[model samples]
Target: MTILIIAQLTIQETQRRRILWLGLLMAISFLAVFGIGLHYIVAELDAIDMDRENMEIATGLLLSAGLYVVNFLIIMMTVLTSVTAISGEIDSHTIDTILTKPVRRWEVVLGKWLGFVGLLIVYVALLSGGLMLVFYLRTGFTISNVLAGSSMMILQGLAVLS
Candidate 1:
């Protein structure tokens, strides 16, 4: 019961932050631009006459670079979000109100962590879906392995946070 209440409040508080919305919008815009750029770059590369092995190697490198960019962006966003979450409340003295409640401190910590985890999960899912769509449209192939690998990276992030 306490965990639920804390989780709900944490989520509500996170939702109330204007920075969160801004970050989300910025991420979406970034993804779109990156996708278009990648599509054009790949198309240009494909136009060059190279041996099958060379072409495959070049394509793999290009896709790997794209995946690296996506990974970096997602990690940066997650770190920004998580680092700010509780510190923001404390800075504003908003945590005092919660501290005065019957809840334990550990509950507050855990709940906030869980709330941030939920937020990160949603962000990652949307970004991954966007990347998959872009890759499919541009190359006629879906990088399931890249998606899975990114998912592991996200989970590793969550583990580190906990």
Candidate 2:
């Protein structure tokens, strides 16, 4: 299918980008630092007055904060990644090869958009899930609301790209 082809190309293109690896490494480092900081903060809160409601609130807040951080990173990466997807190819004369085929210009544009969207979805999903897991392990709390909020960020990113 056209969708699958576009998705595959996008994934391969993204894989070839040095920025992807750099962003990933930075995300991992940031998550580690965030986990350590959250652990200490939660420990301090526990010492103050450990209550179920307070722990829940703390967990939700931590998850929301982690999601926000990851969302920002994803948006930055997505924007940078997409900036050149089409323009770069055209500039390099590679668009001529594709245009010579049966594909229309709009098809190329839509394909690129779909591919980028797919890449963004996978990247954001993994990062968000990892952040959620880390926050859960650190605080023994899971926040569905925070997860929903983070997903909205991905949707927003898609809207911007479209």
- Top-TM-score structure, candidate number: 2
Report every candidate's CA lDDT. 0.74, 0.81
- Over the full model, what C-alpha lDDT does candidate 1 score relative to the true structure? 0.74
Off by over 4 Å in 2: none
Q: For candidate 2, what is the lDDT?
A: 0.81
TM-scores for all candidates: the values are 0.81, 0.89
Alpha-carbon runs more than 4 Å astray in model 1: 49-56
In candidate 2, position 41 carries an lDDT of 87
Please provide, for model 2 over 1-162, each residue's C-alpha lDDT reduced to its tens digit, 9 standing for 90 to 100: 665676678778888999888878878887888888888988898899879897888767776777778878888878888898888988999889988987777878888888888878877877887787788797777665766665797898897787
Pull out the clashing pairs in model 2.
none
Q: Write down the worst ten-residue block by lDDT for model 1.
A: 138-147
Cα lDDT tens digits, model 1, 78-135, are 7766777677889999889989988889998988888778777777777766776776
